[model samples]
Target chain A: MKYLKNAATLTFDPDRCTGCRRCVEVCPHCVFEMHDGKARITDKDRCMECGACALNCEFGAISVGSGVGCAAAIIRSMITGGEPTCDCGAASSGAKTTDCC
Target chain B: MINLSSVKKKEDCCCTPQKNKNFLARTPEITGQAVKSLSNITRERPEWVTGILNTRSGLVPIVTTEWTRTDRIGQIRSRLGGYRMNYSVRPGLYAVGAPDSSSDVFISANYKLSFDILRRALRGISGWILVLDTRGINVWCAAGKGTFGTDELARRILGVNLAGLVSHRRIIVPQLGAAGVRASVIKKQTGFHVHFGPVDAKDIQAYIRAGYHATPEMREIGFTILRRLVLVPIELNQALRKSAAAALVILIIFGLQPSGILFKSAWTGGRPFLLFCLISIITGAAITPILLPFIPVRSFALKGWLAGAAAMAPLVTLTPLGGTSALLDAAALIFFPLMSSYLALQFTGSTTFTTISGVKKELRIWLPVYIAGLAISIVIIILYKLQSWRII
Candidate 1:
């Protein structure tokens, strides 16, 4: 399902994108597209800011403030004081652990 | 020096190693004694490990594709949010089938289910499975958390001495893990090329058959009905647990008659309120997720609020409370929707497509509104109770 409009932190630069299409391959949301031998952000809103494309891109063409998008995690971090994480035990123990749904 | 040949000979005679047996006692020291020692301290070999594979670097534990009754039970338990945080496989190198030095290496999270699905997918294929320590989390969430990440990948690769065990310099990482693993960074650190495979482990066989090239479909994340449905049980369980406590407080509040706690009033007034609370929980936690795409609004909170309102409208108006108390009806209408909206907002974590920025924005706009609505509804209920007791 689509989230908020104009809420994604995803950004791309065509000059740095060598059209390697790594972003196209790595993005689960199909946010990137190849146009004129350069990578372009076709669906900016579809970006979940997972940082997959940016992490996989060797040319530094993509960037985003990627993280877990869960309200519970956000609230937990706010209360416990750390990066947002789902791992309940580790959140208080100062361990860099993250659990899943 | 340990007698590697003697260990190999003994392991070959048995189809399965006994539980708590020292699988590392006779193996070579180079095979990572740290993992073995940790396992030794635990005094148990993971039931998934059927035997050991004799390799050049060391002996690697071999896992089977078949699921035991416990694994199946664990899957169900995890789905229902039991033992979820502790369900994990040991983070190390493992063998599937009769893999050799020339076999391909596949990466996975330490989560038992993730490891199970990966091994099950490689039913006919022989490969080395390098599971990274993600603290029992699935790849997608761990990758987002930076546990299934670059530093961890590099460390695990080196820790396992993967170069000596595999002839190929390439490691196949799941596509979702690309969120944390940088192919270039991994290559630079370990001299191993990271080839992101398909998003789903089920597509691994096809991905390999296609020469490690994943079609767009394989890479795309699909939140189908089954996937969404699978996540609902945990949401339901969690919502119910929290609501149970809230329901108790509500009942106590309903029983407060200014003449102290009255059981009759609590049973009469609180029973209907409790039913509405359940309806809100189900709407927000179960219905909202299942009908997510079809819902009219992009905002999860709004969709949940709307759905909750729709579900409660008939109940509030048609129920006996409607004709008897207008204040109670108004309170029910307002409170239930807000409850649903708050629960629906929490479902954003279960969703695959939501972003941090989007959730933050949603919380910024909706949290205060939910608080205000809750306060107003509580005030209305108090007013109705005061009017009933003639205390005001």
Candidate 2:
């Protein structure tokens, strides 16, 4: 029944997760499910990698590879001196990686 | 437009009333009505409706308010047929009395709501308002469409004879109008300098009190919860009409076909299909906006898809139909949520939460999945048709 490969871009440090379901509440893809009162990335494959959860999280437990799922932002960044991480034609997937969720 | 021709004085409109005739000069006599009563009277009577006696166009007919002492329809019959009044003005002009030559001039759109909001901000102050005719639209929307641009502002200022009315050579404008208005062009035409004010009307009082200085925060646009919620109504209305019609069509198609035995079958019947459509509609429209900030997901389409998925749970877990069409119905269930999710994602244009680049990013990854989900559901439906028709 697996529809997508789990890239596991996010790493959850449960010790630091603070039981804050901000990660659980804000992910549009339903990537996180609650496990034993902690937020877990149960459906990582559903992640389109919008970093709202990480941006809003108070605890340093949740982290995702820094990449905005926005193709246009990556393209604009590429043209303006920054490396593109979005899945665009000329994006450097490795260059702009960050620990963002 | 002051028509002194019909008034008690035939003197120039610019001439200050005789010092004795000055309404503000001798104001010791307090009548039975309180100041609140007078203020209420001013607020209750709209400028646009009151101005109807002067300017009536033939393009639109006038509708009177219940507050009008006489039926407005009767009032229209008494006037010459050629004159038409468009009652589009609102109240709340800034005036303790008429402004003198020293008052600074400000510009605004002619839309009633915009005028009211701006004027209310200027309460108890005396200033000149140079309203541009944007054909009854707010400054932001009108500016976006270029109706409140340089040309209109220049033309309206000249048409209204602003130079003759005011001594000051500066006109303040809302900052949001800068998207379409070129201040340089307006300055060249009218000789009046353009100063951009705060984005919100409520901030105008503070802006005026601070000598028209705008802080950085005043110009920034934030999509607060209240602001996002206001836009939900139009989105829901659009979704209800389109999605409901789509559901009804699908239901009617299922009901009419002889091959659609699921319509009559108790195990996997039309009821579940109806429920599917309801879940899809609610998940996409009503639930998505309210829960958007809270929904755990990276993509809007995915969030909606997840909501749809949750909505499908009761059908699969609680209903007997899931037992008969376990696999087939499950296939249908998977795609149904995706359809709703994709439609909900398109609502980004109406919401202020996501940036254009962010939404584009969301769509790029999510649209393909949405299409694939839809394709899978259609295939399941076709297979169901085949089974009912005894073809497979």
| Fnat per candidate | 0.76, 0.02
* Native-referenced DockQ of model 1: 0.60
- Candidate 1: tens digits of C-alpha lDDT, residues B89-158: 8888888888877889999998888998899999988899999988787898888878899999999998
TM-scores for every predicted model: 0.90, 0.58
lDDT of each: 0.83, 0.55
Task: Give model 2's TM-score versus the native structure.
Answer: 0.58
Q: Write the per-residue lDDT of candidate 2 for residues B80-105, one digit (tens) a residue.
A: 21111221343112221245567766
Model 1 docking category: medium
Q: Which residue ranges in model 2 land beyond 4 Å of their true spot?
A: A1-101, B1-97, B259-268, B296-298, B318-324
